[model samples]
Target: MSEGGIPTIDIEDFPAQMGKLREACEKWGCFRLVNHKIPLTLMSWIEMGVECREIIKVYAKAVHGVGMEIAGKLAESLGIISSSGESEEIFRDWACQFRINKYNFTPETVGLSGVQMHTDSGFLTILQDDENNGGLEVMDNSTGEFLSVEPLPGSLVVNLGDMAAVWSNGRVSNVKHRVQCKKGEVRASIASFVLGPKERVEAPTQLVDSEHPRYMRL
Candidate 1:
């Protein structure tokens, strides 16, 4: 269920591993997922030329599906629909943003931060990190220490963001992560963000009570 202390969730196991998924969100705030079904070719930059835009289009569309799928599972893990029998549509009309990051690392930049530590602002982030370059790190909420996130081939990393924390009424953790320069190489990553649902986001009535009150509103 974990690789090097980082949670590893196999999406192929789905609802059966719902508890693990929820635990990953609550405890690790992020997880590396396998069997996501995205092709390896699309995970690359596609030569970084004239077809860059076209590749992005294809890649975005594919990652978008995975993003929505994860969003739905997260809601289900929260017992949103099963508890109320009401069709939860927190991801309905959600926005997907695609980003391709390129980091130029050098000897002088080694041991430096490629990006500052911060929590994502959206609901979830599906990241295809560089298979050859490993620099991403996530904080271990329990100890307040950052742990290196080693790249797992053919797997994608999912990070719970601020929106997830708000939607789950503090049940989920908004992870803090950063990218450091580990080597002098060109590091690239593709990320698909599942953002606002175009509707007010709030915890389900079932999650809010005298025992467990809502912690945030969006």
Candidate 2:
């Protein structure tokens, strides 16, 4: 890990990262990665950050109470059913505000309280943390335990969300996670979620036989 606990993984090793992603989806629901190559300069750019924030705000505003509209779109994009039935609203809730947390420690500014343990709304998430300070942790559902994750420079942590688990029919798990403030270190992180298109049906598909069906459909 670098000064900020960030891990850097080479893009050339994307296949290996994909394998880890598949494993996280099937078992842990979350995983730490190194060397995912989303540049630090780009990650720290205020203008780019503002643009991203605006896009999220617009999406949240448009899909506020009309979940069906969002569901329809997601279904269409994923090639699923158009109507979500009872699950339409669930997808709507998935479209929420974007959050960016930057931590700094000082006499005037103490570190921030990390987020509580919870699952996200959308299907997938990509997070980039400050490479030096450590703050992320994930619960191992199977073991009923939590594990600390040190930030790796140039790496991105990818996680599946509750929607994905539901769509996969439980085959994929949406892991629970939280962040804890490091005693004296400063930290920062950027997280982005993938949303469903409007008018798309939300449900799991059958990927296997009755003995082992797929958890959820994309």
Candidate 3:
């Protein structure tokens, strides 16, 4: 974990990566996923599994794919799904959306907010932030303070949302965050939200027991 408690996951770590994935979800609720760029040699394996780079050239579509994959892996990390079992069908027919935003803060609007403070309403959000411009912040619920999220280039930040909190029986963190006006240059970011099914989103049976009581009504 970094000084601020946000762990960065390195995909090359294999099984250990899975362990870190679980810990980050249970402890920090979010983490930065590094090493997302696929190796050129994994082409054959990827063709048999998740589709590779050719389909990912379309940035928006790629972001959506990555978000869905991360959400699924998070579920597996938490024992909500098993490797041998079929992918959870909850997200199969649910509503999902992707957004791209460009914020240009002029001198006149300096110090003003680019985006009001709020929590996302979905299950998970994967964001590709601008490498050069900085203006994002995430609240540290423990300290009751806002911390700037300055990820390195080629890294993506994952944030758990309201539904994530409820589904984990309030185990995972759902941070409050906002953007501030920092510079005149336009800051661009693309975010894809993997929303919960409209019917009902509830904690898995294993997550709710005498020790971890159910925290939300589905």
Arrange candidates by TM-score, descending: 1, 3, 2
Per-model clash counts, in order, read 0, 38, 0
lDDT of 3: 0.71
- TM-score of every model? 0.92, 0.61, 0.81
Task: Write down the lDDT that model 2 would get.
Answer: 0.55
Worst 10 residues of 1 by lDDT: 83-92
List per-prediction Cα lDDT, in the order shown: 0.84, 0.55, 0.71
- Candidate 2 lDDT trough over 10 residues, lowest sum: 1-10
Estimate, for each residue in 1-218, the C-alpha lDDT of model 2 and write its tens digit.
11222223233454344444345556777655444333455544422445576554653343232224323333433335433344464454454434566766443433454677898877767676666776687777666676777766655676667877767566667878887776565566666666554444345453345875654444
RMSD of each: 2.8, 8.5, 6.2
Q: Point out the higher-scoring one by TM-score: 2 or 3.
A: 3
lDDT of 1 at 142: 81
Model 1, span 61-170: residue lDDT tens: 99888887787788778887662123335566877788878898988999999999999999999998888888999999888888999988789999999988888899
The reply for model 3, stretches above 4 Å from the true place, is 1-5, 38-57, 88-90
Native-structure RMSD, model 2: 8.5
